[model samples]
Target: MAAVTDAAGNPWFSWDYVQSNASALLAALIQHVELTAASVLIAAVLAIPLGILAYRVSWLTGPILALSSVLYTIPSLGLFAVLAPFLGLYASTVVIGLVLYALLVIVRNTLTGLNQVPVEIRDAARGMGYGKLGLLTRIELPLSLPSIMTGLRIATVSTVAMVTVGSVVGGYGGFGELILEGFRNNFYKAQIMTATIATVLLALVFDLVLALLGRLATPWSRRRAS
Candidate 1:
């Protein structure tokens, strides 16, 4: 392939490069989606219970939130390096790191939403003979759906962006790999632009889908707004 350059002598964008790497791009896109989904779901499972416990035990809340906040602050590359010794360069390292990163958002939002439920509402439920389980499942959870969905939306979008960084873990395929490859082969500006655009588009699409799902789950919120 002849190198195409602009008048400024920089490599110009080429659709041919994107066409040539279409299969790799598709594979990377699928892997990226899978990694994001798995990490978020796993984080939710672990975080929701911790969130509930934190909300119930006032003393524990500070420590729990602190730990998750610290985890979130860890640099992504540094976290991957730390995990590599134990988990190697496998996708699991990426997924586990991402899950930890997601915990702060999920747990904080869960607690916030649950705690926001009015004390009067809880008392009213009890007055009507609602048991502890009934109060949680029927009342608190429903009212907190909006907050939980917001957390999920945030987590999902962030995870999608982060998954690209996982390409550094070796054997991991994501748009990040394409970006790195383009940088390594500086002539391939098309590769860099394609990956960058695709990553942003992926984040936007997932965020919108999650927002729509949030709306569906909390129809009462929409009704109230209208």
Candidate 2:
């Protein structure tokens, strides 16, 4: 295919570039979604319990949030480098790092949501002979649905962005790889723009899906708003 360049003599986005790399782009898109989903799921599993514990034991809250905050501060590439020896260049390294980054948002929001439950509600549940588990599952979790959903949405969007960083760790193909390859191949603008746009679209799509799920989960909130 003939190269497409702008009047400024610089390569620009073209359908030809997209058509040629359709297979690779599709593979990368799938990889990005899989990585983001896996990371968030793992994070939720680990975070929810910790969040509960942090809520029950006030002293644990500070430390738990602190640890996650520190983990979040680690540079993405640096974290990958640290994990490479133990996990090799596999996707596990990326997933683990993403999970760590997501923990702060998930755990904090979980705690916030649970704490937001009215004291009267808790007392009522207790008066009705609800055990601790019942109180948590039926009373707290349902009320906290909105907050937890917010956390999930935030984590999902952030994870989608971070997964691109994983492309730096060879063998972990994602949209980031396309961006990097584009830069490496003399600023192949078409590849770069396509991958970047695809990544943004993915994040927006996930955010919207989560928002819809949140609405479904907490219909009472919508009812109140209306």
Candidate 3:
């Protein structure tokens, strides 16, 4: 049974609920990570390239950035609904929604990091026989890694939370299901516990990973400290 009787006639943590459904819980969490990772990774790949191109071309900057920023203002559910027909009732819609959500931050930060590079340093790279690509790869890319990483970290956290909306469209995975199930069943504690645990744990995990990456990418900042 999903619920059981206690000795005193009060139900406790339903061992059957967890044990019988352990696989479902694991599957849901795994699907959550899969959806989140695919969206974020795709956004990173596409945004970095487009952002770099945007930085290089002054004419493209205003329009491209404005368009991506507009994507951020749209509600997540609305975006999913609009794309659902085309992508169908699956994780593709979720991935597309999340990717759109991530683009503005990623592109803006990439541009910011590239623009923040010192003019004199760039000139020196050119003087040292570096071409545009060489200067970008060796000088601009390394220097900008820290800021880009910051953008990615923010995107990851945001996407992790935002992905809960995916289940609303029938993706059938993630902590969203836990919250939904709890709501439908009037199990407030279940909803609160799963939501809280998923949020806190995901945020902490990503934040620490990004912190380490930031420190590694910008070791010169450490020298300034010591």
Candidate 4:
């Protein structure tokens, strides 16, 4: 590894390093994004439904929340280590951990959103002859878009940060690989800084994109906000 510092021995950002390692960096970033997106998407699919189930059945709420909380309390590295045995250090090991970690946020937010729907709104919907399904799909979901999307943005950022732990498992770590490799090579400043910057930027970009989508999905909220 080249001195992260230039010939003068001062720590410096190296354009040459970026130029030389562009492909590897790009690959790391892409993997990071893919893993984050996949984990969040899967978590949402599971959590949203579980959240609804919890909402509909008060008796189910305690177990569902407790289970997700327990899964989340397991440390990331420990979770990854336990899963790697069964999943074989593949992306799946890391992804499953991420999904589990994400469930708490998504599920809680989803349930909160649905639960917050005004009683008057439900009564009005019922007066119009809307059934439970119709009320949920038509009234509750649309009103809950903001909360659900907020949970998504939070989960996405958190997942991007945690994905680094996957490095211990293998190439599944994305930019984490860069950070780990840089550390292994005597604290390669350029490599580490580059990876750190890319990771932060990725999280910001995802949050922005999700915010835009949420805004578009809830035009009523947008108008009210304005």
Candidate 5:
């Protein structure tokens, strides 16, 4: 009575299909969230320090950004292909690729935020007897919170999209597997549309969550704007 029913005359969607595949959909969605969150977090952890180092050491900025730029230019499929032999066909390969891809934006944004801190502010902090480490921890970082959060939000959304490409490697692609399955299974209308819709929705939801987190983290930004 289910599976595929053209007799209902609507091929674009199927309530029966969604209801039948609910568990699979939930599993895929969970995997998608895990992949996106892990990649963005790892990227942020690495990028922030690298950004700080580059900002501190004037000579390193070119090389650091250049490397991220190179990583960014590599195609997602190509990056996965490169990592497959080392990481194999697992989530790790996808995660490493995502982390690399996320670096450019996050690192650039971090550096930008640090640079945006006025020179006079640094001098003022120094006048208040704050050392370099203390000044950065107490002043520069807090002021740069908005920019860093913006980069994280952007990286998170992009990572969510890139995660679908991982389906090419394995089940690690989350909802991506559903999309691929739909394509392979004679263009299963409900599966294809459902997975596609879910992907877009997931990205939107992640963006909204990050936006909220960013606002909460940078209450000063709101007050300044007001």
Candidate 6:
């Protein structure tokens, strides 16, 4: 094994060190994904329904969306600070705060998706004796899938980046925790490597997933393979 020393006489990171500790690094990355996915899914489950209801009622959209917007205006750290006393300094506080930040994007996209369902198509579905639920499930949802997928893509990317905020509360370990530890301990390469890998990997994976989803949701939009 090779030994490397830093400017402060502390042990510095090297490729060999990262390779030797691959298992722990992998575990941290998985934990980070779990935390980010859980938070986004919870928020989506809540926001999607709220958006649908807001669209259906016509009168509720203004006030309800405004309220969601107001929530978005609150700083993540400030929100976490307020929630920590009740939730305790834990992953839950960070999850709650991140979810709140995601609400506007999810809800607005949901509303846009639902509204984009053509009125003519909806009326025709109704004329064919489709019930409200049938129209929504069979007609509206499928047609609006592209928009909804767009929302999910946006939310997932945002949430992945924001999960770093979790490290402040001992939420989960991953690249963010690595970066935080590095900076706090003045390990510049650790900070740079972790931050770079996390950011690049997050963006790449999410963008690829979103592209695949877009194709699945809109078959008509897909181009023929040469």
**Clash number for each model:** 0, 0, 0, 0, 0, 0
Say which prediction, candidate 3 or candidate 4, comes out ahead on TM-score: 4
Kindly list the per-residue Cα lDDT of model 2 for residues 93-209, writing each as its tens digit.
889989999999999999999999999999999999999999999999999989999999999999999998897778575899999999999987888888998999999999999
Once fitted onto the true fold, the runs of candidate 3 whose alpha carbons sit more than 4 angstroms away are 1-22
C-alpha RMSD between model 6 and the true structure: 3.5
lDDT of 6 by residue, 12-130 (tens): 54666577767767776787777778788888899888888888899999987998999989876677668877888777777788888888888898899999888999999999999
Better-scoring candidate (TM-score), 1 or 6: 1
Cα lDDT over the full model 1: 0.88
| C-alpha lDDT of residue 87 in model 4 | 83
Q: For residues 1-226, what per-residue lDDT tens digits would candidate 3 score against the true structure? A: 5444456644334555557667866777788788878998999999998889999999999988998999999998788888888878988888889999999999999999999999999998999999999998999988888789888999999988888888777854487777677667755453445554765687678778878978987898689789
State residue 3's C-alpha deviation in candidate 6, in Å: 14
Residue 97 CA displacement from its true place in model 2, Å: 1.1
C-alpha lDDT of candidate 5 relative to the true structure: 0.91
Cα error, residue 166 of model 1, in Å, equals 0.9
4 or 5, which is superior by TM-score? 4
Candidate 5 — worst ten consecutive residues by lDDT sum? 1-10
- Against the reference, the lDDT scores of all candidates come to 0.88, 0.91, 0.82, 0.91, 0.91, 0.77
How well is each residue in 1-226 modelled by candidate 4, as lDDT tens digits? 5435767664546777888999999899899999999999999999999999999999999999999999989999888888888889788888888999999999999999999999999999999999999999999988988999999999999999999888989999999999999989988878888898899999999999999999889999878888
List of clashing residue pairs for candidate 5 = none
- Model 1 lDDT, residue 73, Cα: 99
lDDT of 6: 0.77
Predicted structure 2: lDDT? 0.91
In candidate 3, which residue pairs get closer than 3 Å at backbone N, Cα or C atoms, i.e. clash?
none
